[model samples]
Target: MEKQGQRCSGLVLVPCPFQGHINPMLQLGAILHSKGFSITIAHSQFNSPNPSNHPNFTFLPIQDGQTDHDATSTDFISLITALNVNLVFPLQESLAQMIKQEEKKERITCVIYDAIMYKAEEAANHLKLQTIVLVTNSAATRLTHFTYPQLQAEGYIPPKDSMLRDLVPGLHPFRFKDLTILNFPNLEALLQLIATTIKIRTSSAIICNTVDCLEQPFLAQLKKQYQVPIFSMGPFHKIAPPSSSSLLKEDTSCITWLDKQAPKSVIYVSIGSAASIDGRELIETAWGLANSKPHFLWVIRPGSVRGLGWRELLPECFKKAVEERGCIVEWAPQKEVLAHVAVGGFWSHCGWNSILESICEGVPMICQPCFGDQRLNARYVSHVWKVGLELDNELERGEIERAIRRLMASKECEEVRQRATDLKVKVEHSIREGGSSYNSLDDLVNHILSI
Candidate 1:
């Protein structure tokens, strides 16, 4: 590691332009900046982060050839494929200009890019610059990327409905239906993306946004497969100083509402930025929260509910039912919401970031995964970690109500709450002076400096 007061190297970070992917990469940038590295954020123009929020770092915008409509489009695979093809040359040109301008004041060290933004790695490689890959998902999810080909070879990719309940042969605890592969619509395109992402190019090290205690087995498997150093130093929101990286404006009024509620009495519901629900499911969710007998804070992101532009389409009856007990917002400051004392349970989509935040805060979850790694994450949360319950069946008001009550109020779930609390304690320890994440972070910084 660089000496405490020494000038550290300048590092450029290229984040995938999505809420989930952008948050951790920026948080990572914050962490490195605190460690004395000069930070440059080279991001795509579409859904670009507000530079004002991170004024300390230099922001470099690369033309991604995406319009506002493209950014708002729900077709994830096509968007990703287009971004990969379009960003390569512009990113390379940006990096080239940066090197020329900053060569004298602060030598550019390496480019650290989100794994999904493989083109960033390509651009940096063309410039003969060192690079590091940041895996923003769980180690378990990353492991599936390696095993997908094998699963396909065994004819399990488009799994039979009969086999859905069975556990995968090598990847234990993951059922056929729980595979990330089953969630995407275009199998060939997703598989191609995965193949390209998993290939090792010029990266000197790999960094994961996961805790070692929760994913030791998967981390061990990954270490055996890759030649570069692997670092598990995360729950990045906790490691980095607090800052707003939200693409959508967050309503802080929810925090005030949470304050008025009784301790451990609220259920926080947010399905994440990308996932969408049908009108019927949204209606069920509204009624469920209304009848669940707990104070609830729900995020109904604009355009997240199909056929409904926002939350306005909900029936007046459901609105009246929840009028007194529920608070709904377009988006919430989730970290703040999860950390609140009134948030006893989370009804989440099991996005890795949300899972880590919930674990860090000692809040039990009601796992309702939507797609991709979320399915696997929900499985682990409810089964492997034993800190949450899953909603496996289709959305129904009664089932939703029961799930919420079981997680937030039932005596039977005290054990789950206790386990969540224990994990929270462990997460706290992992960031302390002598802990796993702390040591891993030191190793990562040293590795970056060595490059």
Candidate 2:
């Protein structure tokens, strides 16, 4: 075991209390810990880390005064507001306690926080500690968040609810329909979050989980405008393997099921941690999956539907029909499942993590975006990268069946598959030795140490 005194320095990581945010922040922590840093995770009480999974890292669960069940009951904007209001003092107190105990042996050198949890940054600033903002989404999404005020002032937002295509200057191929944040029900609260997130300008540097090749233009513009150094050191999961901080117990059975299927023959469907579909849409999706007639592995989280007891609502006939060909689980070991030989196509919500993982595995996507960065990610997947097909808002069985067949069997899909494979090669190379992501990680480590 590595002794405390032998470690070079201590670092605190504050991830937002969400599965998507927690997983990447913990992966980054594991990567840094491998590089001689003493990893300390100071997380909110809501969605706290399972210490058993990360035994090496010191876990400090800062109280956000939220119960485990709050995740299902509380609305997103309210939860975010409560987190900012409640967690700051506990975070500062935790850092102070750590400093008092370990300062002589291994001082807490810096605090790396999720940019979404801007309150953590405020606390770090108040303590006069060095800080690095870890951005968990795409560079394009980050640009959207940062430039939201400009978009509002320029009269591009509060847009008509119809899907007419328009453009924002400097954000080409990203049309009015692609703007996700503005469509939120709580637009004011989201704008407030954006305003707070931009205070990341006060941090020592910004660490984003995106490679330059995928989002070069946004990264370039961000670098030129911001004084702080922006390090695009990712495809993060590849950099640190077997490093998942999932709040749910992933079903490993999916892997065993995948083993029996033919190569590149299964559609892997997962929407992500926090999207819920209405009753009609859920029924449509069920019919679509059944009509597609391809082998599939789908994740239907317990509360992913609007109605009570969603399991009872899935058509009995449809369930019986697909039982032989489809597998349904609450959650699966996603990275492992994606890399399985049987997964040829992804039916996804296009969360940044899922998108990168699919790209890494050379799997083409059938994009069905729900909210937030997903819309933009789908746009890029279908339009810019040409590695996926985007679904319309109306979830028709025919459209869904057609998309699956095209992605799985059509001649046009071969080109998409090849494009995804080529990008997979590029992604693999980026995280390898002396590549852009590798060099960026090295630079970030040095920058953190210097502070």
My TM-score estimates for the predictions, one after another, are 0.97, 0.96
TM-score of 2: 0.96
lDDT of 2 by residue, 240-358 (tens): 85766889989999999999999999999998988878788778888888988889999998788878666888878997889869998999999999999999999999999999999
**How much lDDT does each candidate structure score?**
0.90, 0.86
Task: List runs of model 2 lying over 4 Å from the truth.
Answer: 1-7, 67-70
RMSD of 2: 2.1
CA error at residue 268 for candidate 1, angstroms: 0.7
Candidate 2 lDDT trough over 10 residues, lowest sum: 1-10
